[model samples]
Target chain A: MSEPRFSVGQRVQIADRTPPVHHRVPSYAKGHVGVVERVCGMHANPELCIRGDGKPFQRIYRVRIPQTDLWAPYEGTDGDKLEIEIFEHWLELAQ
Target chain B: MTGHDDHDHGRTFQPDHPEPTSDAALVGLALRELLIEGGHYTAEEELAVIAEMQGASPENGGKIVARAWTDPEYKKRLLINGKDSIKELGFDLEPYEFTVMENTDQVHNVIVCTLCSCYPRALLGMSPAWYKSRNYRSRVVREPRAVLSEFGVDLSDDVDVRVHDSTAELRYMVLPQRPAGTDNWSEDDLAALITRDSLIGTQRDLSTK
Candidate 1:
């Protein structure tokens, strides 16, 4: 069981890689940088559990991504935000 | 297998007859059969379980919201741990995390499960049909303003929108800003304003007007 690498308020980028397997990270959020909203506790690795292996538990974080950064020609206010839960492996600390 | 044929094949089709069972429904039926056959749970037990789940409704959530509006201490606790706070009111979201999003003057919160229909059933009862639709799951995360406006909740530009995607174990409920002209209203009256859609953040500005 690995401790959480990212803390709340830290900037992290979603892993751009899209493997041909089941995952929780939404496609629109892939490769985008977002701030960690909250550090959710560990959860069973869904990607692994689907294939019958649930040994490794993962630390999940709620990442807050601005809608303007997500969609080009954004029509909503700059304050508009989209927050989603991302597993540890799908996120990397971004500059 | 009745196709809309131009030829008069049937005298009259039953308007009440729905289409064949969907693939997901078939799979669910199969799983239920297997479980019953294996003596895991009796058919009556399954019915009882479903009956309890269907019995849940938004009124349970309204009680909590009304309490939070009237009690500052309970509100603080509810904001910190929604699942536990609700247990005080005889409702719980165990085996899952329940987070309450407070709607302040500038921040408006909405809940959606983009990957799937992961709703706080313990609070909002069963998830509405639209909440589980692909159209909402995809569009709300993108054009939230448009989607919100369609629901008759038009927010000002200063009010930031936060769409909480319940993709994981956690479930969320929005604590709407208490309506005006209700200062003297009892908790029962206040609870009446906490509609299912308002709790989900699709409706804003709860009012007696």
Candidate 2:
């Protein structure tokens, strides 16, 4: 079993690559930075699972991105947040 | 009714749209018949599973929330292990991760799945059409407070609003605080007040005094 790449509260950024097939990462979340809120359990890449690709699994993390960071015209207060479940393969440690 | 049918003549009624069948539905129908023909399972057994699905309504979630409200230990267990805690109540939330996000006086929480319509169908049955709408999927994550206000949930500015986007495999449900006036209410009574929207965090006011 592979160890989780990121921990809760760690800063990470979503990878910007565009896969040709189905993937869990949303277009809106691509290339964005967020804080890991929870290390949700590991699971096979849903894109592969749907295709019966028989690929190994990776850890899924719940990352909390601030609304203001996601949208420049965000109207809510500063503390507002949007949390998304992202797989470990799509994330990298932020500087 | 027979006289009315005679007046309508031998012509059968034809609606504008033919029941709006989709490719997915047709595929599902074919798969079911194929499975039955192969002797994998009888149609009667399939109906039993259908019956089980019919029982997967928000009422089960209400029972969990109500129990959590009355039992502190149960609430802790739910926060830590939502799947196991729900199973303790004889509810099945299998093949998915069930996470309970608690709403406290300091903060408010709402759930949305921005990527496709992933939800806790085993616990809440089919998600409302609005929950699956593209407009909602896009707007809620960007403007949760504004969207929530449209649902008649206007939290004060001081309270932080957190919108959870269930983008991947896990599913989320809100664990709203027990309303103030319901301190003396029984578990069953409290469960009655729990709305599907509240379980999803679109609404929080559950006081029934």
Candidate 3:
């Protein structure tokens, strides 16, 4: 498997795609920008273009973002943040 | 802890359904028996764990909440990496490891595992039946604040609701902020204020109110 392109503290954005039927990615986070918090090693990639191939690929990263970035309209006293695990394929370097 | 019964085990066979246990039930029964036979735990210890598993008592979560309430530095550590921080409190994360997230005024946190029930079993014990149900997994992400309200957890409209979807590998636990009325309270007193429902985002920390 290839090493993940992104590193901790690197800014990245979620790829644009129709959500998978059974996905670990949350629906609210699609197309959002966040910073990589941790590289959670690699695992068998679940999003296979064709099913039953049994070819495993992909690394997962833990990403963090201020709550305001995800929810623009959010207004709260304490600045909150969220951390999510995103597969390699779902991320692209933010320009 | 005070209002609700800590633990209760009472069941009588109902006349409507009189049948032998199914394969699934047998498998579950055998799994428990094997655990004891393997010397993984004493029968009494197994029962205690099982009771917590059944949601009779949320021992681990209560401890986490207590530490967060009393210790500022520990709370920071918990927010960063819940699994290791909880171990510092003398709780084992062996059976099930967990990822802890915090929710503040600006952000609200909720957890769901879409494919299967992935939960912080080490800290929160076994996931509740409701957490495993499809209804919760499907609806929480779509309408988090509304769903929380149904459970009597009504957040202010301004609070951002962030729902976490756990996959097969990782599980999530939400650490709510400490309540206000707990000034000068001991760790034990603060722990008593945490409930199983609170950890799951179904209820708030009663100490705050």
Q: Candidate 3 — what's its lDDT? A: 0.69
If candidate 3 were superposed on the true structure by all CA atoms, what would the RMSD be?
A: 8.7
Ranking of all candidate structures by their DockQ, best first: 2, 1, 3
In candidate 3 chain B, where is summed lDDT lowest over 10 consecutive residues? Answer: B6-15
Candidate with top DockQ is 2
Model 1 clash pairs are none
lDDT, candidates in the order shown = 0.85, 0.84, 0.69
| Model 1 lDDT per residue over B1-209, tens place | 33425432112222244543789866766776677658797666766666777888888889999999999999999998787888899987877878899999999999999998998876789999999999998999989989999999998999999999998878999999998778898999899888999999999877786
Candidate 2: lDDT over CA atoms? 0.84
Which portions of model 3 show Cα errors greater than 4 Å? A1-4, A8-38, A41-58, A63-83, B1-57, B94-97, B207-209
- The positional error of residue B29 in candidate 3, measured at the CA in angstroms, is 11
Q: How would you class the docking of model 3?
A: incorrect
Judging by lDDT against the true structure, name the best candidate.
Answer: 1
Give each prediction's DockQ, rounded to 2 decimals: 0.76, 0.76, 0.16
Clashing pairs in 2: none
Question: Residue A25 of candidate 3: its Cα lDDT?
Answer: 72
lDDT by residue for model 2 over B1-209, one digit each (tens)? 23333432112222232442788866766776677658797666766676677668898889999999999999999998787888999886676788999999978999998878888877887799999999998889878888999999998878889998888778889998888777899999999989999989999888685
